[model samples]
Target: MTSESSPTIGLPAGDDVFPVLPLRDIVVFPHMIVPLFVGREKSIRALEEVMRADKQILLATQQNPSEDEPTPESIFTVGTLASVLQLLKLPDGTVKVLVEGVSRAEILRYTANENYYEAHARRIADNVGDQVEVEALARSVVAEFENYVKLNKKISPEVVGAVTQLDDYSKVADTVASHLAIKIPEKQAILALPTVVERLERVLGMMESEISVLQVEKRIRSRVKRQMEKTQREYYLNEQMKAIQKELGDSEDGKDELAELEEKINKTKLSKEAREKAQNELKKLRQMSPMSAEATVVRNYLDWLLGIPWGKKSKVRNDLNYAQEVLDADHFGLEKVKDRIVEYLAVQSRASKIRGPILCLVGPPGVGKTSLGKSIAKATGREFVRMSLGGVRDEAEIRGHRRTYIGSMPGKVIQSMRKAKKSNPLFLLDEIDKLGMDFRGDPSSALLEVLDPEQNQSFNDHYLEVDYDLSSVMFVTTANTLNIPPPLMDRMEIIRIAGYTEDEKSDTSRLYLVPNILMEHALEAKEFSVDDEALKTVIRRYTREAGVRNLERELATLARKSVKELILAKKKSIKVSPKNLEDFLG
Candidate 1:
């Protein structure tokens, strides 16, 4: 092979033995020249040995580039026999050298060397076939490569000139293949081909693929350039209009809104840490344009900051007698439940900082499990909000969806506080036993933190991403059965409200249900009176249930039936007796 700037060197003869220098991420083909920077000690030693001896090295590529010192087996068996054309030592303790591939060689065996690897290799000459076919393949490869160079201008123009000048079919194939932008594996495949025809065919296929990729990349770059130009034009136009408006004293630019928000943030009583966070976010919002995406996110963040109650707490009434009176007035025949609530109130009165227990009311339907939450809220003079958690399946429903998800908002616990407009309010999570589970997540498990008074003080909603104080909030849960999970049940103090007896129902009907139903039906109380015997008859024969719900319905029916008589015949006073009750009831 002819050399440039250095003396020409011929191919090795007989069983040629040469020092092996492994390459990474590059393949060297016969008639192709390349420069390598040797950094590894073993590779540097191998290069120095080649320059001192025959100035010829077995330049092969390693399978893995990361291997600092590769064994003989880790390198490709078929490689280039290259001559050291020129050598230069750099200041970084490394040597750089130019080499030209002489011929294809196959390693027979690795020789034992202390510093680096040495292998005995045999030269493999190209088996040239019919001259006409080889010329045709070389011409096809050159045509495709020229087209590739046009699409991708990063390749040097000199490579195309050198390829066009070569007439030897084998040399033209190797020259174009080495310059193509392909990976080492594909290049190695071409180097391993025995005939010039095979190498030319493989190089043509690879260049076609590279050309297709370059066209796609060109289209993407063009699209990006157009978008950038459009954005630049719009930006300049907006800047000019803003300047003109400002010169005419006609620019508001959200100044009044920004000033008003700033005043509210300073005047509002927020925690020191929360106040500082809001100020930093507000500064970012002030710096951004209203049309920018970040401006909306910053505005939402500030809204949450200013909207929360922060340090505001509802007033708690801890009077035990008043609380008992409230319980008895709102509900009937729940003495045990009332006693537990009064005891909690008494404890709260003694210690101002004591947290309320998570009280779960277990009973049948219409037994006032939900109403008890309202009575407790009224008795304590705090706001009341009830969240029916019947078929809740996702934990996110309770703890809130993260803000990253679209349409995400605060959870039921946080939403209740916002609805009540207080940090501490009465939260009734009704129908706890009816909670469901699905692939989304288990919601009952999320109640673990909310029910625990200690952890609830720092309950962090995924959407809020802030610790909301819930220690002072009274959480009263209700369920019809004890089907709740063990971990969740362990957190609350379960109170059982058994069904009322026959006599208890009779008296409740007289004191609360009868009077309330009479007023609801718009019947005058003084005109019609339902006797105890008639009420007992209705309980025994007409309706049967654990609670006073059916008994109340029967009384409403009686009031409506008597109202018909009062409206039609002007009958003012009518007493319902057990003997004549069926006539009115039926």
Candidate 2:
């Protein structure tokens, strides 16, 4: 809605025509100078044609910007008449033109041509209103624009000066509407309005909506900034408080805990070398800041040092009769295995600082090799622990993982010692011959130091980084075969646990397996019982193993089936017989 009084230079008079260029998603209002890159063949040709004659062209915007080739129907008929201010030829066959919109135009008819698009356009002039009314409206529009500029800090303050300098009310309205933030179609609507008052009114409504959105965004940004400042202040205050507390010596900060650990370590009777190492580690811990990562490492090492039973040993039973009685009561058959353990206990009770042999019980599975270890524990009054060496390829598992590695821990020997809370315990290394080797390292080689009494008096682990006394630890290793590493076999006194005879299976089943089966099924011995004949049938027909493990399983199966029959048939009692054994088993 620009004034007709202003000169429209380069614009054709009346219905005179000029070349046309299609714009996408952009509305060019009168008095707006914009630079455009002309890439389309028709648009580029139109720019060249306009540059040749009067430097004028009609600029129309398309309805859908996504359309590659827009028909006349897709473009709005009401457009702007623009004059080319400057022209530059780009290297990529595209021409860049600086154009200023001269006035609004209406397309009456289009001229068909091959080189460029031509249209017959009529220049539109603003419908002037009363002079007094126009002046009052201009004042109102300028004030509202000031408020809009305050909301959007991005809008230049020079726009207020430009609006004030323009004397014509129509030109002021058109200039302000052009700079306002709004949708392209809304701006196009204002451009097409014939009267200045209509354009100003539409612009005012849109300006109010834009101010509301900007106000919300500004409030959110201000709140976030305040919250961030508050968090930073709180963090600064907390750090100052920590500094004050540390200066006053009121903070625990691990110092008190470290002192208590040091006192405990000094009071305990440790070897001269171990005590010196512990004291040296404590000195380093005192020098480190409590919050640092290295301090935590020192603290963990001190905890391991304090946890070991430095001088305490388990009380050994010197009476050989009590040891033999315990062995006979716990396990049946394998008198040879039981006799060997009793002899070791008798020798251990008599000698001081004696290097006893590491007893290796080689046999098939479930033949009382592991049970013999437990019986040894009961006989000597020592705690028992079993470490399975099967499928162990890492030497770190036999020795310890180095402290540099994550989740590093002591080996099975040191861990068992810590758990037993004594210097001596019966450690059963189960399935020793089954140890494996791979790229990690061989576990069997690491076990050599652990089993040898000469090397084991001061066994050093990679993680402990100190010598641990394993001379008092009674080691009993069990294996299913005699095929073990030569070095490991040399340290141990190998005892054989051969497969049981049919008579041995029958006796073990009746004494140990039968009572355990009844207890497992939660049945009373008077309500259900297994006879010697039925036990023999299970040993001969159902099971064929080197140990009593299969015989135990068969008895458990028979007990479960017989218990179910008693519950269903409402019988008071049931006897397991050889002939009726299949009825319960099936």
Candidate 3:
């Protein structure tokens, strides 16, 4: 097919095949050329497979597997089928290949034996016969691309023109569309369009949108730069004033300042990590002769570190009776679960008690799963930190993104501790069962360390890449169901918070619900309060849930509506009865 009259010969044309190339942001069409740099282990293996195969490899978009596995998907049903024109291995362990798109194809199942993801492809219809205004579309698209090129930062107009005059309109659109800075999903949409006119129109719309976004981004960057410049100048002025004042100091004045600082430093107890950071800052002050406001900024940070509550542990009264009292103060039922929490606190009374027993509350929504964790924290006089695991599919989020990635952060465990402003506090991991599996990574596997007490004491997040002490921290987890991983599930003590029985609901409402509802609905002391019969009527007639929570809401509703009427009608208050339930509700 090389150095021939036509890209594909009509004489005894070989059986048509499509190689499902899975490259992103770059689409190659027949008579359209694109270059790819392959270096990853997957890419290298893919190259090797293609070099060895008798027929060309079909490039395809990856498909996800039904089961949880590391494999990617097959190519999109509509993709450019291409042949590798040339292949050369670079010194940097990358394969340099020139590939030209050939025809449209549908991807079959993944091929075996590949370093890169490859799919078996069968050709779709050749060049469409019913094209009407495709050639005019190509010219108009070319002009649009030329304008797009001039608009792109630093892109050469000559390069754009060369791409435009190429033989295939489909290839031109694909090549230009690939580099348009459109979102991946939008690019996939363009790839999926079946016809030349459709593909061209989609690409044009996407390109225009990309240009608009670029314009907005340029304005945003300029505005930010101006703001930063103003801030830096202000900082420079403040530090210059401080330095000038210090320069006018006497020997004894310096001594006095040093003495005050030394006294504070002596009083300051520091963590090993924070102390080391402060010491480094002091050394920086000793060094770096061409100092600026940034240097002064570092010195200020040192001062803050000296003043911070490092090596400070909050006072926690570890009495089981006290914890029980706190729990009873707010919640009415869940007697069994509350008792277990008290037992946990009793065990904490041991001098050498192992970190806390990881307690997971399994129950339905509004069963006070989150509120209960807060109550436990209040009972122990410790701070509570919550990490919601719902919709957390990225492994980076659960385990922290790798620090090498831009804006990487510590996993939820490390982040929660930092947020609580304490190394040891009560951590509530919510919705542990709702983690999703995706190409980014499985969040469940990422939770392996944070939930495991043995491993969690030295939990390492990918972003922080530092092992944090989670041993002394008490961890609580909540889920609607016990659908958590077996290994993770085994590590925690499961406390079942059953739906309240009808009798329990009625009793709990009488004590906790009535009073709380009165306070929340702003009802006066003399307001017609919710009586036993009225509350019972409302609960039986209005709603039915396992938890008294909904019943409590209904009670609150009665108070709110009646309170409004009490203020409006001067008939101070009406006694709530089964017959008068409609007055409050309606």
Candidate 4:
């Protein structure tokens, strides 16, 4: 409807009374046309009253859109006077009305009406303050509104052409404000402004802010679109390359490698749990790119899994006499240790399936504790592997680090087993008492699972993520003192290796140390000789130790001096005696 026709039909002969319509979410500005869906009873009544009489309604925004029936205080004082152009009553008991805003109006008072809300209000004329300032703001707001329409695809471009053609600045400001996607309170504040310059300025500021936000949103959309396209392009190229390689028969190497691993997985005698885990990891490896880092980690895990001696075992020497002979030939005077080892061999010979005993040899430093482990391995004919637990503090050092960690691997236990190359090896854990605890974890606690006969049959490594059989492997631990943790101490049978007696040390020097020192010095037994009294004097005077380690050092020194004496004196033989022992030794 035209502006002149709407004002003439709304109020006749200075009557300010009009039907009041409370809008829920919109603030209607003058010169703006909008469609309203009237659902509330009072709203439908107000629309019907205006359609029947003057087709005029005072449209005010509700303070709270959630309010079903708004009181006078809930409605804004200033509103737009709108003329109803068309009204359609639907079967759902709602009226759809098309209304054209005519002018701004101020509510004077509410009139008593039984059917619907009626309000006495007067039209509010626009105040044009300083034509120059109003003209400047209108131009800036129009420019910004055009930019907003371009950035925001929701607004029609035709609206910008319609706004620029309007000669009245007040109408231009109201037209721009109506099209803006701003909140109700902000639009209401713009409608409440009396001066055209003030309304245009407020609209300009809001348009600029909206334009800035839209520009940022546009940039983000462009960036995300580019990233998605790049990812899709790379994926397509990789798939095409794979297809080309397959057609040319160039992908057979990778296929052959995977097939070989699959064959190994089938042939190698892995336990039930371990075989299942290997198959699952291999499936994942097949799906992943060969060049990817994650694929390498999975491949390394499979290598470790396949590298373990699953069913391979060395033949355990069953002869007790041979074991005793080997033990006696290696060590001098540890009769008790040798006897225990021979007993173990004897029992293993008779039993069908025997789990190796966990032996902890407690002794002083340099008392042949470490050497005894080697001797036992030799006598039993099992592969020997030694892992020192002197300063091991991380539990990972024993149980292995998880595969999630970078550069992670199986713990010392699993690593040693891999090196042993046999399922049943003599695994010696040296310095068991020196196992340390820290924040990473307690190595001693981790060893509990390794030493327990009941639990160690299915020893689990973190990186391997599979159970390994340790039932056949013999574990020997040596410590300087019995200062081991009680839990660890409980798992193994303790064998105390006491210091050697004076006589035992003398015999050990005469028999073991002297021969080894002569062989090392390149001197034969005929050329260099030490009498029993001279050896006793050297042991009693020069060295004072519980073990034969110091006596060995003293004997080595005498061998070196004997070599020097034979070279200078041109003598065929050099005899070290107690009479001239200080002359040679000092």
Candidate 5:
């Protein structure tokens, strides 16, 4: 591939012997002057040997730059012959040398040396191909290189100016190739080119490829810059609007609302997961527009979260005597149910913390099953909250609707807890057997979590999306029959209240029912009276029920008739005995 050759660099007459210096990560080209720091022992020794003699060294690129000690086979045979212009010894035991690449050379053989690498190489003469074509290619290369320099800021304009002054096509091609920001292999390929025209064509093609890539990069940078500017402009206008609004005395109510929520979040005693969830929701709420429906939902969620009686509980009444008195005063008989409640209170007083038992009071409707729940609350000194599970089919009714639904809220359990304003409350699930199943869901299934002592500690509500503690709540459920799901039934301790006996019903009416009826009818004890015989007659004849509910209703009728007589008939006081019980009943 050679034509008329140019005179090569002067070398030794017999053989071109030079010290070999292996380079890492760089390929030195002819007409390129570069500074190198020599740290390796062999590389430094080679530099010293070259400096001691004719100042010419064989600079070869290692096949693997990572190799600390490169062998002859590991180095490229074609390398640049560089002249050591200047050398400086640094205090760090390394030598800094200024090198100018003289000409391309190929190693003939490596000589054995103990101190450093020694090699015999021959200088490769440059070939000037077809004079006209070489000249034309050289001109085109200079123009493309100028464009490349303008596009690539790393290469200075002075480099392009210096390249334009070279008349020899080989020197022009070498100068441009030396300045290209190409890989070591690509540069070495250009350096190995024997003809000037081939080297020039390769360099020109590389420059064009680099220019196209640079143009694309420039377009991308401009587009990104414009987008950034638009975003900054919008931010600036928003800040300006806020400032104008502030000057006009228009305050940001949204900020105040968020601040209030944040304050509540900090003040409220929430579990770690619950607090993090609230903070995350607050962050989302801050990002949303105040007028949006989503913002309203988030606000409501925050309100519910803060509204819950977290870490707040009524001080349980530990006095067994007081609890027994309250239970005995509220209802007569059902001694088993009253004893169980007293036992629960007794355990609570001794234990530091106890999972309150889920007590299911199963009996007929009028047997004081629901009223027993209230008495237990009063006995234990816990707030009373009742939720009717009657006809409740939707699972959401117990566990709550997911936040994704419109106008979603926490389930009745949480709502009742909020109403009770205590973490530990006597929660009565009334008419639990009336829970129905349909397409909506089986609410009884959801009640399993609320009633289980093991799982209720971290009861999760779908709307809250966080676990709430229900372990401390005394859950009492009332059912007309034991028609509950087995899984749910398994979680609760069943307390059956067989209908009261005739003796218990009579005692209840005299002690609790009659006094309450007379007071409710606005009649003094002296003004209206029902003797024990009259009350028994009313209970056996007019209303015959196991519980005293019907007995109380009949007594209320007697009180009403007595009041009517006192108003219309002007009776001083009415005493209903077994003899006159028929008149009051009629």
Candidate 6:
């Protein structure tokens, strides 16, 4: 409930407000100043609101503002009450505003009236002392912060003098830490630190540690910056590529470069099987626009054809040790499912570095299916993504809605592929059995080419119109039942996800679930105890499901019912008992 620290020289008159722009990775304290360029209509309007309102605003960050409409979510309980100090309108129709943060405020979410952002907030109450008295720590922190500034990339050391004159120590420390020219997640971690002291300590530690290994740090920074710049350049180039592709009209059926290649291969004296394979590749390529990323991927893919030793494989051992270790580390039980996956990997090791068969795990709800998929990804060192097909009936859901449809997409498969940013991923198609067919189209039938290994190597999604090699993708599907289409089911190796046995549930209760339940309720385990018999009774009498669905609900309910009584007993300086379960359960 304390206020955020500010950065401007003098305290903000106890009332002058500032607009807190809550970006994903930036955290500014009450006494900290954040500079933002306002160009987008939404951001411009934000600045206009502050300027029109005399620079008073709740500058809070949000995950998604547009979706919630008008109200951009206020991230943390603590945020700066910033005020507009200076405003400049640029010739390019952009506004530059310098806002002064006054105090910290606790925002209770947001409520919007118009197209801008608004929130209900109360001032944060930080009782930390001023910086002048803590000279040693301040000197050490500031000095370390100066070094942090120097070591970082894209940041000039000249900014240090201005930083030292910064009013709030915490704000200064966090600001330097924020703009440390570090990774987004690293910056986010610094911003998310609760106390200025903690932030200073954490940042100083990283700075001191990294500075000692200065060469390594510099090398890493240089490499990362180069990679990032390269990626941005490539992304822009790709956009331009798309525009050019659009300028070129459609390729007539069987008349593109790929089609001609197919004709040549067909006329050659190749075997029927070889001819068919090359023909499929050509057809897929012809369908793909040359300038598209998919076409680029396909073109590059043809290079492998000249080189792959036909059946050469890697040295992945069939031993169950690594897989077992990973599975046991992340999950409690489901040994059968784990064993099957390990076996699949073992069998796949014999193949020429191609994908293992797609696995669709079918089980009742809440049997840790999704988590298991993640663990498998971790085990195989592959990225993981989940695409739910529960209510999608359109063929476009599996393939993609054609771009001609106005708001077109490159299919869930393509999106997932993009998300992983890799050719190979442990793609989890969740709730496959739940996928339904309605007026749009049967999405499951469309998934046929995607899941079918025979055709998925050249999977031609409708929107992409390009045959993407889904063959490299180690796809996994999860279903609550075995009622999935036989064609779809046939393509996958099914792993039955059974409910946790009572003993397994007991282990989870003691190990993972109960501790989390206590932490969430903001209570210690010592506040209350459940007898082994009571736990058994709760599991058997109150809940009956193959999954831990009801078990989670019951634990939550038990914690809620006991919390008030536990608090009352604590106030009285006494103990509470298991008999208290009745009030909660009832």
Error of 1 at 184 (Å): 77
TM-score for candidate 3: 0.49
Cα RMSD (Å) per model? Answer: 18.0, 25.1, 30.9, 17.7, 10.4, 37.6
Please name the candidate that would achieve the greatest TM-score relative to the true structure.
Answer: 5
What is the full ranking by TM-score, best candidate first? 5, 2, 4, 1, 3, 6
Colliding residue pairs in candidate 5: none
Candidate 4 stretches greater than 4 Å from native: 1-256, 355-357, 564-572
Write one digit per residue (lDDT tens) for candidate 5, span 181-207. 888889889888877778999998998
- Residue by residue across 458-509, what tens digits does model 3's lDDT show? 6666654435556667789999899988878878889988777667777787
**Candidate 4 residues 218-239, lDDT tens each?**
9999999999999899789768
Of the pair 2 and 6, which is ahead by lDDT? 2
lDDT of 5: 0.86
Tell me how many clashing residue pairs each candidate has.
Answer: 0, 0, 15, 1, 0, 22
TM-score of each: 0.54, 0.56, 0.49, 0.55, 0.59, 0.45
Better of 1 and 5 by TM-score: 5
Q: What lDDT score belongs to each candidate, Candidate 1 first?
A: 0.82, 0.82, 0.68, 0.86, 0.86, 0.66
lDDT (tens digit, per residue) of candidate 1 on 1-586:
1112212223444587888889998899887778899888888899888878766898899998898878788999999999899989899989998999989898999988778888999988776665677778888888888898899888887778878877567788888888888888888899999877788889889999999999999999999999999989978876775576567674485567667779979987876766787788887776666656777777776776677676677888888889999998887676877898888778777876656567899999877788888998999998899999998999999999887886677788877777788877888999999999999998988888888877888888887777777787778899999999999888888999888888988888888887887788776678889888888899998878877788788888888888888889888777899888989887
Residue-level lDDT of model 6, residues 1-586, one tens digit each, is 1223432233323432334455443445565666755666666677787778764677665544333332343355456677777778899998776766666666665554344555566664433354443334556767876776666656677677866776556666655675565554555465555555656667777677767777686888889999999989977875675566666764343245564565556455433444465566665675556766676555543322212222122233344677789888777788888888788877775776455567888888878899888987777777788899888888887787664565555678877776675567778888988888888888888888887777887777565454556676677889888988888887778888878999988787777778888899887767755767778777887888888878888987777767876677654221323465555675
Indicate the TM-score of model 6: 0.45
Better of 2 and 6 by TM-score: 2
Q: Which residue runs of candidate 1 sit more than 4 Å off their true CA positions?
A: 1-255, 287-301, 568-570
On a 0 to 1 TM-score scale, where does candidate 1 land against the true structure?
Answer: 0.54
- Candidate 6 runs further than 4 Å off: 1-319, 354-356, 566-578
Candidate 2 lDDT, 82-112, residue by residue in tens: 8899999999998888999888899888888
* Off by more than 4 A, model 2: 1-253
